[model samples]
Target chain A: MAETIEMDDRTIAIGKNHKLFDVERIRADFPILHQRIHGKPLAYLDNAATSQKPKVVIDAISHYYQAQNANIHRGVYYLSEVATQAYEQARECVRSFLNAASTEEIIFTRGATEGINLVAHSYGRRFIQQGDEVIITTMDHHSNIVPWQILCEEKGAQLRVVPIDDHGELMMDEYASLLSAKTKLVAFGHISNSLGTINPIEKIIQMAHQVGAVVVVDGAQAAPHTPIDVQALDVDFYAFSGHKVFGPTGIGALYGKEKWLDAMPPYQGGGDMIKSVTLEKTIYNDLPYKFEAGTPHISGGIAMAKALDYVGQIGYPQIEAYENDLLNCATEALQKVDGLRIVGTAQHKASVVSFVLESVHPHDVGTILDREGIAIRTGHHCTQPVMDRFHIPATSRASFAFYNTKEEIDRLVEALHKVVRMFQ
Target chain B: MDTDLRDLYQEIILDHNKNPKNFHKLDPASHSAEGYNPLCGDKINVYLQVEDGKIVDIGFEGSGCAISKASASVMTTIVKNKTVEEVKALFEKFKGLVTGKVEPDMLELGKLAVFAGVRDYPSRAKCATLSWHTVMAALNSKEEQAIVSTE
Candidate 1:
C-alpha cells in the first residue's frame, strides 16, 4: 500500500513495496559492505565515485583469467577460439544493455574520458572547422568540457556554454539561443554528478538535431541509475564507465550510431584494428575494432557484461523507486539540521545529496564523518564550474547505491549532528 | 576517537582559525606568492616584507578548511621579525612534524606543537604545509609572481 509521509512541511508518497524491494538481499550480494571502518559499521555512501562489485561480477573476472586466457581474433588454437567467442559475446551483451541496433555500434574504451577523446579526435578533425561552434552546458563534467575545449582550440571553433538556473536546471531558452546552423557538436552529461540533476536528454537531442549538430552524452552517472536505449534517444554517441556500474575499472562502452561510426576515421591503429598492413599502405578493420587499439582489457570486458546482467536482474523500476524514496528521506532529514543548506534542489533529481554547513567547511565535515565510518565524497566532484556557480568552495556529497539502507542514512544524519555540535 | 579528533582540532587551533592573525594583504609587501591545493580547492597567499636579512612584516590572505587556515594564520604570527635563516629552519622543523619525521616537542614548537596530530591524516599534511611553501616561494622569488600547487 502507498503511504504518505509528512516530512515537516512537505508530504512524500512512497510507492508500495519500495520498502519491500528486498534491499538486504541486494546488500548480501556485495561482499565489501559487511565490514568495519574506524571502529564502526562501514557506511559506503560514495557510490558515485565507484560502486561496490557484486560477487557474480567478481567471480566472472577470476573465471575469465583462470580458464579462458588467450589472445582474441588473431589466434586459431582452441583456447584462442574460446577467448575470442567470450569477448565477442561480451560485446553483444553490452549492445543489448544499451539496446543498440547492432554490436558494431559499441566500442570498448578505457573509460568515458577516452570515449570522449576518441570522438573529439576523429569526428572533430573531419567535421569541425574555423568559426564553428561547439555547445556544452555549465553542468558538464570536466571530462565532457575539456575534450570539446581541446577540439575547439584545434579547429579554431568557438565553444559556447548553456547556463543553468538557480534551481540547477538548464535554461532551455539559452540553449536554444546557442544553437544555430554553425553549431557542429553539442556535448553534455546525461546527469550532473555534483547536483544530481537529470537533464531532458530526449529534448536536448531533438534540439541539437534541428541545428544538424551531433549530440554526445557522458552517461557515466546515468547508466547505473536508469535504463538507457540508444535507439530510443537517437543520441549520436553515448559513453559510460564500467567501474561506476558495479564493474571493473579501466573498461567502458561507447555507443555510436552506425552511420556516425562508419563515417568517423579510426581513433588509433594497432595489431587488431587492421585489415592488412603493408609497407606502403594500411587499411583499418571493421566498425568497433577500428576504435579499439592495442591489447584491450579482456577480463574487464567480460566482467562488465556480468555487472550489467546483475543490474538487469534487479530491474531499473525497482531501483529507481527505492532510491527516490531514500533521496527524499535524506533531503528532508538534512533540511531539519540547523544552519545546513543543500546545494541542488532540482525539480527532478537522482539519489545524490550535496550539502554544506554554515560554519563548518566540507573538508572538516568529511573528516569528522570519516571517524564515524561514513564515507561521503568531499570537494568539487570534478565539477569546479558547478561549485563556482553555487559560490561555494566545496560540498560534502552522500551518493547512494541500491544496497544502501535507510538506517545508514540515519547514521549519517546522527554523525552530521555530532559534527555540527563539535564545530559549534 | 573523540580524543584523537580533539588532538587535531585543539582549542588553540580553533581560536587561530576563528580569529586569524595577520589575515590580510601587506599593502607594500616586498614579495608575495600564492599556494593552491587542487584536491580540495584550498587556496592561500603569503606576503612578506624583508629588510636586510630579517623579515620586517608578514601576512596572509585566503579561504580554506580549519587546518589550512589556522596553519597559515599561526605561521604569519610566528615568522614575523625572525631572520630568514631561522624561518627556513622552522619550515623544515614544521614539515618534519607534520610528516612524522620529527617528534613534536613542546620546547621546539611551543604553540605550533598542536599540529603533530596531522601525521595521522596523510592527506591533510599538504593542507597544513601549503602556506609555508608559498612563504618560501615569496622569499626566493626575484621579480616574477610566485605560485605553488599541492597536487
Candidate 2:
C-alpha cells in the first residue's frame, strides 16, 4: 500500500514493500553520497562518527522551518498548535520505535551524552549514597565513563570497572562477581563504538536487577544497527543519539521506566518542566516533561521522526542482513593484507571494522586514504580505556551502513595495499 | 598518488621516521618537556642539554605518525649547538612553514621546508608542530612543567 504524509503545505507519497533491498537505490536517497572528493568517488566508511542524512530527513527539517515554525506547548495560535503536534508526535514515534511502555517514559535529550548525564544527576542524587558502587566496563565510550566518574567523585562512592578480554568482549563472569549489595548502578554501551562488539546487554540488565542495581544503557551505536525493545530487555534506562541513526544532530531520546522517573528529582528547571512555580516553591511537571526543560530543538525533533520513518520503511531485518554481508566482506578483505591486524574480533559484531598495519600509524593511513577520497576514522574513537586494554595507540576504523557496498569495501582493500606498499 | 601526498611523505621523512636521528632520552638532561596530542594519540618527550645559553645537545623519544616523528628527529639536528634565541626564531619559521602563514622561500627554512605540504591538510599540521611546541616549552620554563597538550 502507498502512504501519503501531509505536512500542512507539502504532501509526500511513500510506497511500502514495493521493492527489495537495493544498495544503489538506497545510496541514491542520500545526496551527499553522489559528490566526488579529490577526483575520486567518495567511499564514506565513517558511519560510526556520524551518519549522512537522507534527502527526506533534510527536507523534513527545511519543511519544519519553512511552514511549521512556532513555539510549542505554550502557544495557542494555529502555527503553534501544528508545531506542538509535530513535536509530541515525534515523541510517540520514539516511544513506538523503542517499544517503551508509555509516551511519558520517553524524554527528549541533546544526545546520548545528555541522557546519561540526566540519570547520573537526578537518580544518582536521589539513590546513590556514600560508599555505594557504580559499575562500568573497560569498553565504554567516554560519555558513559565520565558521567559516572563525576557522580562517584561527588557522592564519595567508588567506581568499579568490568574488564574486557583480548577479543574486546566484556568478561561477563567478572561483571557478575563485581555486583553486590553495594552496587547502586551499572552503565554500559549496547555496542562498542571502536571495536564493533555487540554486548550481551539483556543478560547484563537481568544481573543488575538481581542486585537491586539500576542499569543505564548507552544505545547510541546499537540503534542504527539493531532493534531496541525497552520492555523486552527490562532495561531501566536506554539512551540513543539522533545523528547516529541518520537523524539530525543535537537531538536524541532517553527511555526510562516510570517508577524510577517518578522517584527521581527533576533533571533541569525551566518553563515547560514545571506545573506551577513561585518564589518560595515550585511543583514539577509529570514524567517526561520533568526531565525536559525550556524550549527544545523543535525542528530537530520533528525531522528525527522522519528519519526514524525512513529507517522503518527499510526494515531492520533487511538492513542488518545487508550490513552483515558488508562487514564480512570487509573483514576478509582487510585480513588478506600483509601485516594487517584487525582489532576487536568479538563473537558478535556490528558493521564496524578496526585494523592496524605493522609499520604504518593509523593517522598516516587515514591521510593516504583521504587522497583516494575514502573517509575513515583514525584514533581512539573516544574509547581511551579500550585503547589501553588492547595496548594499541590507535586504530583505523571503517564503519558501514546499509547504503555502503561491496565495491566500496574492495576499494578500501586496494587502497590498503597501497598503504602497505608505501610503508614497506 | 597525488603530488600533495607524495610531497607530504617524502623520502627524507620516511628515512627520519624509520630511523630517527637523536631518537633517545638525554641522560642527565637539564631541561625536558613532554608533548602529547590526545586526539592523534601522539606522545613524545623532548630532552635538551643547555650550556652558556646555548642548546648543546637535543634528543627526543616517543610514538607518533611519520610527520611527527620526522619533525621531532629533524628538530633535534637543527637546534643542537644553536643559541636559545636562534632556536626560538627557527621554531617561528617552522610553525609558519606548516601553518601556511609564511611563504617557504621567504625564510631560510633549510630541511624544514619539507613540511610545507602540511598546510594543505589542516588536521595534520598539528602533528608536524607538536614536538616544536614541546621543545619551546622545555626551553622557556625554568622548572619542568606538566606535559604540554596539543589539543
TM agreement with the true structure for every prediction: 0.96, 0.96
Residue pairs with backbone overlap in model 1: none
For candidate 1, write residues A85-162 as lDDT tens digits: 998999999999999999999999988988898999998899899999999999999999999989999889999999
Chain A TM-score of each model, in the order shown?
0.96, 0.95
Strongest candidate by DockQ: 2
DockQ of each: 0.74, 0.80
Evaluate candidate 1 and give its CAPRI docking class based on DockQ.
medium
After best superposition, candidate 1 residue A407: deviation in angstroms? Answer: 0.8
Tens digit per residue, CA lDDT, model 2, A232-322 = 9999999999999999999999999999999999998898999999999999998789988999999999989898989999889878877
Fnat values, candidates in order: 0.70, 0.70
Off by over 4 Å in 2: A1-19
